[model samples]
Target: MEEGATETPEELLAKQHRKEKKDLQAKIQSLKNAVPKNDKKRRKQLTEDIAKLEAELNQKHEEELKQLKSPADTKVGEMINGVEAMTVEGGDQQEVKQPRVTKAQKRRDKKAAQEKERESRIAEAEVQNLLGERHQEGLKLAQKLAQRQLQIREISSDGHCMYRAVEDQLVQRAVPGLTLVLKELRSRTAEYMRNHADDFVPFLTNPNTGDMYTADEFEKYCSDVEHTAAWGGQLELRALTHVLQLPIEVIQADSPTIKIGEEYDSEPITLVYMLHAYGLGEHYNSVERLKDPANEEDS
Candidate 1:
């Protein structure tokens, strides 16, 4: 082996340039590969960088061609080689264009949007129908209760006939806890509405009718009260409105209990059992306390 072999400055600089160029090419490939299969933003940036590099390479190729036309044509071949190394070393490194959106993908997106819109319409209609039915049922029950009370008052005033027994029978059949049942139903209904509000359009209070409309009735009313705002304010009123509309059946006074029309019209049973089962009967008894205005005033 030679005692002192030293690398020349030109050779060392060429080695350094080759190493730096190789590292830069690797970095470019890594970046190109970093573009996700489904990410539009990332692919967009990669496409930009690829375009820039292609443009620079093309410019260098053109400059090399121009030099080859002059007396200083010796360097042109080196420039051409550099241009080819920069542009074509990685055979896969063509312009990184945005992924094409297929016709099937466009069709899928459109179908999904259509299905969502159809479901929304159906849901809104169902909710509205339910509200209307509850309203009617509550009114019927309220009228029946009021008529029974009037009959009892009339018979009790007579004070000297079989009518007195009839009065007692009517009171017993009235199921002292009916109001409590209504209140419980209201609470449950409100809670259900609260929990599922995201699916609902939103409840809008109408100033003109003092009625509430679900979202979708946008122009006349604010679409929806925020969740926090909707929790309070007219819940009791809304519930009472629903309760007053239940259907009434004037059964024989000997019957153990009145049948609640909504979500329950099953076999006969005690008032407490029925109310507790449906979560309505327990609160019905509290209606009596509410009837005493003096107590309310004190509170």
Candidate 2:
């Protein structure tokens, strides 16, 4: 064991260069193994970093070769070996590996997400257009109703918009002692329709057979009107007019104002029928007098 051994700066610099090169390679592999391959931005950044580290490693290798060529610095230590020695020898301990998605798969998923967003935007626009049309109908109907100093009072659309709207007007006319108004009105209308079958029966066609209603079927129809929340329409309106002996005015967008029981001439119960007020089907809203003169609507 000779105690006089000494090392030159060139040899030490070459050892450091080898350690730095090893670190650069590990850093490049770590960058490649980063997660979330779908992140194009992060992938681009990693590509840049790997390129930079590789360039530096290449430049240092050239430097180490030129330094080691001198005969005096030829006594360098053995090359750093194995990933296990990386901590003491430049291992890049913080680097981790994760599974990555294929480029094709990532692109497909991005395209699908973009398509889904486009469809959502389209559906929203269609809904907005429908709302705009409903608003237009409201504005048009408002023009006719304004003459009487009345505004539309919205009725619930729970399959009984017509009956609920008629109930609203009946209450407004100060019909006294009206308990369970909708039930009472429906029962009265059905009874009238049943008794005056000659007037109503010829008007209704059996929906299933496309023929005139049989006696049993007409009775069932009346039962449904009173017992179930069956939707009300033209025939029901006519029956209601005779039952109450009251003129009923139906303001419509498509046709001239309908005057049911117009000959009665007492005051009219006013309602508006909207063809597209609801998405499912036509709907009715009751007419009420404006609360104040300022509430008068122009459109």
| TM-scores vs. true structure, each candidate | 0.19, 0.56
Residue-level lDDT of model 1, residues 66-142, one tens digit each, is: 43454423333333234322223545445433345566545644654575476457546534533553333433333
Error of 1 at 195 (Å): 19
Best by lDDT: 2
Q: Which pairs in model 2 have colliding backbones?
A: 86-91
Clash tally for model 2 = 1
The list of candidate 1 runs beyond 4 A from truth reads 1-5, 50-299
Q: Candidates' lDDT values, in order? A: 0.37, 0.69
* TM-score, cand. 1 vs. native: 0.19
Give the count of colliding residue pairs in each prediction. Answer: 15, 1
Q: Ten-residue segment with the worst summed lDDT in candidate 1?
A: 281-290
